[model samples]
Target: MSDIDRSPKAPDLYVHYCEHQGCDNWGSWGKSPSAAVATRWWCFEHFPHKSFDRNRR
Candidate 1:
């Protein structure tokens, strides 16, 4: 069997806008795996004029 058939299928991955309510910005972001969980993720946004501390949460 090919790699696609050997491994369990993963659903399509998509970058959704940050779930921070009231902010409907279609974020052009990417997903990163959370350090605490293998199945969890963090979405990073590209805000050219702003600074963010990813480790602060």
Candidate 2:
């Protein structure tokens, strides 16, 4: 077998999102099942609900 074939397979990339509404940010959010379809996704400006909420408040 060639070295190319011996190389480890790349990790499967999944669609991740924030658990907020009306958000479609697909990326790492330090959450599990990161690739699963999420209820919502928060953009950089709308991440970390606690902070986002406080800012909105």
Candidate 3:
């Protein structure tokens, strides 16, 4: 067998910040371009397309 490490590495943790200018809130919402990619992240207040149920929390 070859001496190559092929095991999957631990997932990288990324802390996304809001896309709005000067906003420091943690970006908990993600806008996906398609099923495979998330193009932008935003905080609850700055997120444009928030779900109705999300507001009830």
Candidate 4:
């Protein structure tokens, strides 16, 4: 058998899919300034709205 037979199939990661459910918009790495939140892949619609801080003007 050839070495190719032993190789594992690569996963089809729709890697840029938005973190939000039911939302298929293209996504990218997202983050919040607050230390309490973890960074994750988010779409353009949600990326600017993720916030942990309550105090705002």
Candidate 5:
């Protein structure tokens, strides 16, 4: 085993695109367990409007 901190890190450089139908933004928000959100991903622009309902309240 190796000692490493693999926790989530901030997105400084371009990682990936949002999983929205036709979005072209970088995916800043996403699920950890992979079974929470339907699309499982959304950019900082669309997450609040789409995944909030399922995640919060």
Candidate 6:
């Protein structure tokens, strides 16, 4: 088989940091309900959506 490159690019290597101010945790969870809504990233502690209450605001 011919040689091929399957490495992740620079953007792919980027780590999304928590959007919360003064927080530097890795943003592993993100929400983007619709195209019009901007994506919000946050760590487990800062994620607004809780397991017990999805509609809590």
How does candidate 5 fare on TM-score? 0.42
Each prediction's Cα RMSD? 6.8, 7.2, 6.3, 5.1, 8.1, 4.4
lDDT of 1 by residue, 1-57 (tens): 566565457788875564445666655553334667433222343442232345434
How do the predictions measure up, each by TM-score? 0.27, 0.37, 0.55, 0.40, 0.42, 0.61
Q: Candidate 6 on 16-47: residue-level lDDT in tens?
A: 99988999999998887668888889998988
Candidate 5 lDDT, 1-57, residue by residue in tens: 457867587768747678878998888786553455354667877776644566555
The ten-residue window of minimal lDDT in model 4 covers 48-57
Candidate 2 regions with alpha-carbon error over 4 angstroms = 6-9, 27-42, 49-57
**Top candidate when judged by TM-score against the true structure:** 6
The full ranking of all candidates by TM-score, starting with the best, is: 6, 3, 5, 4, 2, 1
CA RMSD (A), model 5: 8.1
For all candidates in order, the CA lDDT equals 0.46, 0.56, 0.80, 0.66, 0.69, 0.79
Worst 10-residue lDDT window, candidate 6: 48-57
Clashing pairs in 3: none
Candidate 6: where is the Cα deviation over 4 Å?
1-12, 50-57
Better of 1 and 3 by TM-score: 3
- Compared to the true structure, candidate 6 yields what TM-score? 0.61
* Superposed Cα deviation of residue 53, candidate 2 (Å): 12
Candidate 3 error regions (>4 Å): 1-12, 35-38, 50-57
- Give the per-residue Cα lDDT of candidate 2 at 49: 55
- Report how far off residue 1 is in candidate 2 (Å): 4.2
Candidate 1 Cα misplacement greater than 4 A, ranges? 1-15, 34-57
